[model samples]
Target chain A: MADLALGKESSDFKKGLQAGISIGIGYFPIALTFGLLAKTSGLSIYETVLMSLIVFAGASQYISLSLIAYGTGIFEIILTTFIVNIRHFLMSTSLNEKCEEDQLISKLIYSFGITDETFSVVATKEGTASTGFLFGVISVSYTSWVVFSGVGHLIGANLPQTLQDSMAVALYAMFIGLLVPSMKNNVKVIVLAVFGAIFNSIFTIGHIMAQGWSIVTATLLSAILIESAEVIKAKYRGAGHEK
Target chain B: MRSEIVWMIVGMGLVTYIPRMLPFVLFKGKELPPFIQGVLKNVPYATLGALIFPAIIFIQKDDIWYGILGAAAAFIAAFLGANVIVVVLGSIAVLALYSYLL
Candidate 1:
């Protein structure tokens, strides 16, 4: 009995480690960019470290950096990040169901480390997600992000302009890589992407909206519109089937 | 460089903690509503779309054309069943070429 229990524990540990490995691959590049950008944004090494420790969300951190670069107010930056990350509220709503009662403390701890990659991993798990497993996921990811960010910040500060230019292209490439896999599955993703681009262009290029709020507005309005259309489509399909 | 920037970063760090910490405390032992659950199910599609659509049309520094070309190349590459890395590289290649030529 004891050995059986030990076997299961070891297996779950391996599972968590595998999750961490896959997550670390995706996160390392992006977090490296975040660190590099933070340093370039006039933040010191300690400040960049602390920001990664606290914010954890790569997209928001990058956007926040740009906002700061644009001289947006502190309050506005926070507000926009809050809106951008509002999806996490939904992510957490799904996550709460997966955690165990006794493991609430660990859940809270690991929740602090929740990035999109980690959340997607945890959300898809069946049965109780072991604390060991969650931490295993968090530990590897958190360590890699922090370490790479430090490396990037230190190295990035002294790099020549040509090198910075090439390193910067990695981000858009990364975004494309992140997005293309998912877009393959669903047509609606393509539609929303289109609307999001159009909305952003009209608002940003046309000078029709405040720059600080432009992307936020585009994301929110497009999400609502896209999701609403899907709901209506589903309802119509249901009604047609009923008749 | 200034002391105020350090203070500002610290302040932003502090403010971020509220949301990160709040969800754990507020939702302990609670089940989310069904509609909310449904909405959560679709969030990936929503957020991904929201992120991608803007990428194609708007390059920073007010350069929209190159960005749009990049996005279209990405979309076509994606539709052809290319991997994400391939799609991204294709877009970058196309955009870089366009920028150089035009």
Candidate 2:
């Protein structure tokens, strides 16, 4: 019985590793760009790698670097990171249903690995996601993210001065790349993004608040306002149909 | 400066970890309220928008066009349903070519 169980677990882990290969490949350029940007943002290679190792989330880390570049306050940076990653709360809650029952410690260990990509893969798997399989997928993706980050920083260090300066544009370009797709998919995303951009521009240009605080405030305001507008619109439509 | 960065990273790690972990630890089999879920869903898009603008224009202070052109390239790539990697690399390629011509 024990041997059979062990064999099953190993195979599940192997299957997970196989599933994660594409995610690992997908992380390469993104992580590489992160490392390169971290270098340009004045982070030492050690600091860059440490951020990737500890934080592990791509968009938030990229945002942090930009915040750091702005000389934003540390507390404010933390707050912004929280706001940016709040979506994980929903993802995690939803994923818990698909994951097999496991020990609290095991869940704790694997939950740390629940990135957007990893979560999607595990959640969509045909059956319950095993603890061993979760570990397999996370291990590959996490390793790729951290290792490529270091490599990108090393490459960035050797680039010509002009190229390094041009790299600053890459970060903003990356943000646009991320936002545009979601904006295309949902008009709500379009409204949220446009509102966010307008609010942030006002706060930043007007010097009404520090850059870090501006982002946090703008994000919260846009989300709350747009969501409220959506709720009110739904209510009005419902009333109209009744009449 | 070093210590500040360290503390910042530590704080960030804690905040990031808490959201990802709390649901698994505490929310077992529960769902968030609809309004809250809607707001959370909107946060990423809003944050992304805030992150991009005003900052993009200021990225290349001496050459604002550099920033604008790079953003245009990224927008085009992303609009065409390109993945994040292609969008980034495509913008970088465009900027590199622009710089070469300049």
Candidate 3:
């Protein structure tokens, strides 16, 4: 029985590795960009690799590099990275319900590997993923990011300026890809986004924590508005039915 | 000189780990309310929108026209129900070319 269980676990690991590889495939350009940026920011290869391994957040890492390159204060960089990543709190909160029971170790291990791409892919899985499967996905994504980042660092300044310029589209493309799937069922999302963008723009004029706060407010406000609308609509419908 | 940078990077890593790890620990055994869950469900999309929406039109300096162009691209593509990749690539292609030219 022990041997059989061990075999199952190994296969799960293999499955996870495959999933990770798939994630890595999508991560290619972003990780490469990360490498380029880190090198340009004067991060040594070892330092760049460590950041990829530790922070493991593509957008936040890029933002951090920009901050460093601009000579932004340490406190501000840390604060900004934290604020930008605050959304993960919600992602993990939702994921907690679906994770394996009594598997705190697995949750901790896998949570570190969470990314926008990973969360989108993994959250859609049907049931509680085995600890092994979780690691499989994380390992694949993590290794791909680190390896490609290094490749970028090594190829630093050698990459064509056009290619570097073009890669800026990757993040937007990835987000839109993720958005298209959901926009179909949710009109509230459209409303929220529009209002959020308007708010963000207005705040940008004033130079507030416009980037971070605009998003947080828009999301919260739109969500609240939609839910309230639903409740009111349901009440009116009930009244009409009674009449 | 670079070693100092390495220390900063290391410090960043340590700090980032806490946020990633804390949620897993605090929410481990319990279930949250449905309202909270609903709110949480929408955050990823909300976060993505916030991050991308502003930058779409206004590249760097106060550029209102760019914002309109971006919104138009997203609106048209989304209105036509274009696939995310197509919409993304099309918008970027259009904008990048437009921005470079203008």
Candidate 4:
């Protein structure tokens, strides 16, 4: 029985890695740019690769580059990384529900590999997510991100100074690339983002908080407000449907 | 200065690491309440929006319009559900053109 189970697990891992191929491909460009930007922002090769290896969160790492460029303090960067990656807490919890039981160590190691893309693919796999499968998926995606990041830094090192400077604009465009899809899919998302941006702008203009804090505070406040409105609206919709 | 950079990365790693690992350790078999789940689902959109909007408005200090053009390209590609890499490339292509023409 154990042999059969082990064979099933190994096959699932292979399938998961196969599924993760597209995700690994997807990560390459983003991770590469992150490496390039990290170089532009004055991070050492070790620092750039290490950031991807350790933090492994895309948008937060990009945001940290901007913060570093802005000469923000270390504490603020750490705090921002925390707040930006806060969603992972939720992602892990959700995946835990779908994932089959395994060793605690397996959970510990694989949980670190959870990102938005990995979580989505695993969750939608049309079966109970096995530990072997989850490990397989994360393994490929994590490796692509770390490896491409270094490649990008190397590429960045060779680019002309002029083009390197121009690459700065790509940062904002990248964020928009990540954002607009979600906004189009949901009205509530659009409102939440707009309000958060507006609030962030006010905080920026008012000198109300440091740059990092301003983004953090605006996000928290906007999330609470928009989500409260959503919950209330959902209640009304539920009531109306009942009638 | 470089030492400070290393420490920051390590620090960021810790905070980032904890969140990803904690729930697996703590919430292994338990399901969260529906209300909490709803909030968690909404987090990315909310966070992404806030992160994108005002920052998009201020990209190039001198050439705000330049920033808008790149943003428009990103918006169109992403809204159409182009793959993420395509979305990024679309924006980069537009920006490269905009920079070259101007």
Query: Which candidate should be chosen as best, given lDDT against the real structure?
Result: 2
Q: What is residue A194's positional error in candidate 3, in angstroms? A: 4.2
**What is the C-alpha DockQ of each candidate?**
0.32, 0.48, 0.35, 0.48
- In model 4, the runs with Cα more than 4 Å from the true position are A1-52, A55-106, A114-141, A148-158, A161-185, A204-207, A210-216, A234-240, B1-12, B28-30
**Model 3: per-residue lDDT, tens digit, B45-84?**
5555655566655543456675556556755675677754
Q: For every candidate, give the share of true A-B contacts it also has.
A: 0.28, 0.73, 0.36, 0.60
Residue-by-residue lDDT tens digits, candidate 3, A1-243: 999988887897887676555456557777887898888888888888888877888878999999999999777887787787766665666566666674677677788887766665455455666667777878888888989898989888444544444444444544555555566677766665565556665666567764555556665665556656765777879865642
DockQ, candidate no. 4? 0.48
- Backbone clashes in each candidate structure, one number apiece? 2, 0, 4, 0
lDDT of each: 0.63, 0.79, 0.67, 0.75
The best candidate in terms of TM-score:
3
lDDT of 2 by residue, A1-243 (tens): 999989888998998887676567657767888999999999999999988988888978999999999999999999998877776665676667667887889888888787766765565466678888998989988999999999999987445646655665655665675567566658888998899899999999999987656777887899889989988888979865642
Which pairs of residues clash in candidate 2, taking residues 3 or more apart in a chain or in different chains? Answer: none
> Which TM-score does chain B of candidate 3 obtain?
0.73
lDDT of 2 at A213: 67
Clashing pairs for model 3 are A16-A136, A20-A140, B57-B66, B57-B67
TM-score of candidate 4 to 2 decimals: 0.65
Lowest lDDT sum, 10 consecutive residues, model 1 chain A, at A161-170
Better of 2 and 3 by lDDT: 2
